[model samples]
Target: MQTRRTFAAGLASAACAAPFITAAVAQSATTIRVSTAAPPSDFLNRALERMKADLEAANVGIQFSVHPASTLFRQGTEVPALQRGNLEMCSMTTFEVAQQIPELGYFNRGYLFNDHAHLRRAFDGPIGEDYRKAVSSRMGIEILATHYLGTRQVSLRQKRNVKGPADLAGTKLRMPAGPEWLLLGRTLGVAPIPLGMPEVYLALKTGTIDGQENPLSIFSAAKLFEVSEQVVLTSHVVQPVFLAMAKPVWDKLNPDQKKAVETAAKAAATWGDTARLDDEKTIVETIKGRGLTVETPDLKLFREAADRAYTGADATKAWDLQGLKRVQSA
Candidate 1:
């Protein structure tokens, strides 16, 4: 079996039939400072760009200035940037959100989401509404939409037959610098090293870490395929990132502006989600062409290991198990 993942061009709008908001009234442009660690090539960015196009075409007094690839804010800084009024929007990660709202950490747990669809179900429906409220109340951020990031897999610089969690023992794995992600490192039986995104490539090339894990879309877009020799498809986390805006900023918007933003976000998510799902279906072959060996590990073993890591843990004692159940059943 081949482990594989395209960001289809989503400039105008994503399969959205809703007519553009055509209010002819013009006001001072509200320039939203969008920042992301994702490259312009990322499907999320493409969708955001598409939303920007839709918003601009709507004649809404909105200017979406997207700063991609950490040009504006480095990884782990967007949340604060939003709070400080330095940034207007970003694709918020569960890992970062869990930092402040600890119980929300359940979303960061591996194997919790059956797939992208299940993940979205939790966020798009009642459970997602609950999450949005929690974030808005506790952190002052408003979630506009949720989009799929591909399933996570382990990409290593050295080829090894990784059939189970133990196979990765003592392997230094690079994870986002945080207690939560480091916890995931321990679950995978790896020596976790905390590093920023911009430093990963040089670290891999310099042997500072043995491997890293991310969605295949990220792996390909970052060109990690060029540095890593193998990909072990653990498929642990079916990741989803949120399109978010600062709560105060969102509140300050006029009714029509708010409607335009919401409409654009919805259109963007719909387009980006479909593109990402398609990318996951075909990306492995592209990486393999660059001389990477894709391996399917014992996924059952991996899932069981992740489940064991969270059970009866004091840190997760306050988690919303019922909500998790709802997401699982969804």
Candidate 2:
């Protein structure tokens, strides 16, 4: 009778442990790895944190492991890693995508977006959907959300005041090593010197480059004011970072899992967008407080130059001018 009682007890214990064991297995099976080139303090990283919190709160069995500041993959390799199925997700720039899909470079065109509202309409509307489709079909990556990085502006080292594009003529400016960026530098009347992001600080400090262009937040984050003497509010290019997942990984998600991820991604992007917009307002004063001269030139000249670049044959070769016109009108 004691043996039968013990057997009954064993069955009861097994039954009690089954749910726990199943949950553990489910959690282990759904681990996700997300990578980004942004530092831990960056808005992009903060957004990822928000995403993690939301996903976990939804009681999804998935687990998120974040790697920031290019820890998991080197700079410029994130996209390739995602394509190869070596990574689950990443925050990538449209410039990187433009290298493969040159037509996508249209979005990077100088002064294409009039303001944040215009940009939001274009991206959150049909243009965004079209680009997402193209990226999924051509690159095998699924775009979840678009997060604003910041508006690009010029930061100079020698206290030179730039009133217009003409003032930047022959000035050696650090630019990203991409065709569109090269063209932009040329259009803006600067001698374009291609450099990596990690090298910009040392390049400025050592006088390897005369100036560089980036949003105020990036300038402050890198503490570029220490080396930079002046800031020109060019607001040349409005950069948007893409929150993307490998198509293979995205395809494996069930409907509910996909919905959870999408909701989290959009929420995180909204957080990043709001944070960046707020930062843009205050970062200029913060930079000025550090003894850097700030200038707001007649943006008319720069805008005209940008318009010329947009309609040029080179730009037209890669972009759908009609689509661009539609975005502008929208």
Candidate 3:
């Protein structure tokens, strides 16, 4: 009788433990590390938080560890890291990809986008798909969604009013160290001084560079106003930010996980786009209130100059002029 009782107790214990074991297995989480160059308070980081929340709430066993402000990988290194599978994901600008695939530089061409809506339409439609395929094929990274960076503008050390490209001639403007960026600055009649982000502030403060161009949000976030006295509303380039994943990491995801990631990416992009647009509306006022002279220059002259520079034979060799025209019309 005791032996039978013992066997019954053992069977009961096994049955009780089965549910716990199954539950533990089902709850196992997959952690993904995502990195961005933007700070935690930036819209991009907020979007990343939204993605994390949605992914975790879905109970799909996926989680995210976000590293902001280039903590995981430095600004320029993100691309190479993603290519080598050393990093899982990054929020990066399309210009980073253009460095490798020169044809992608079409997106960075000055004054190419008429407005934010035009830029979004191009990305959400066929043009974005074509670029995504090219990036995957050449760089081994998959673009998840398009996010807004902001419109590029020129900020100067003093209230040096620039009415046209002629006024900007010989002015040393700090730009990202790249052929495309240099070409853009040169086309605008500025002597482009290639500098990294970290060096910008010190360079500006000590008069190493007379001016720089970036979105107002970046200028505000980086506290560039402290050094800059005037902001020219050049709006030379309306560029889009990209959420991308290393192809190897993306390939490892199962169908359900892939769906979760895609859903989260789209949501994050929407959130980021809204935040950026809202911020742009009031950022100029905020900057001006901080004692900066904001001017809206004759953008027509700048646009004409950019068009002439980018349509030349050498420039067209790097970018598809016809494709660019199609995007503009689209």
Which lDDT tens digits does candidate 3 get at residues 1-330?
999999999999999999999888666766678888776777888899999998988777776878887788877788888888788889867678888888777887888898899999899999989989999889899999998888889999977768899999989999887778888996678999988665788899999999999888878877888999999999998879888999888898889999999999999999988988999999989998998999999989998888787766364577867887889898
How much lDDT does candidate 3 score? Answer: 0.86
Question: For residues 1-330, could you state the per-residue lDDT of candidate 1 as single tens digits?
Answer: 122102333433543423433322323578787888886788878888999998989877887878878888998899999988888999899998988988778788878888777787777888889889999999999999988867888899999988899999999999888877887887787899998877888899999999998888988888888789999888878888889999999998999999999999999999998998898888988888888999988888877887788787666776778766777798
Candidate 2 local Cα displacement, residue 101, angstroms:
2.4
TM-score: model 1 vs. ground truth = 0.89
What are the Cα lDDT values of the candidates? 0.85, 0.85, 0.86
Enumerate residue pairs that collide in model 2: none
Question: Which residue ranges in model 2 land beyond 4 Å of their true spot?
Answer: 1-27, 309-315
As a whole number from 0 to 100, the lDDT of residue 93 in candidate 1 is: 93
Best to worst by lDDT, what's the order? Answer: 3, 2, 1
TM-score of 2: 0.89
What TM-score, over all chains together, does every model reach?
A: 0.89, 0.89, 0.88
Better of 2 and 3 by TM-score: 2
lDDT of 1 at 168: 98
For every candidate, C-alpha RMSD to the true structure in Å: 12.8, 3.0, 3.6
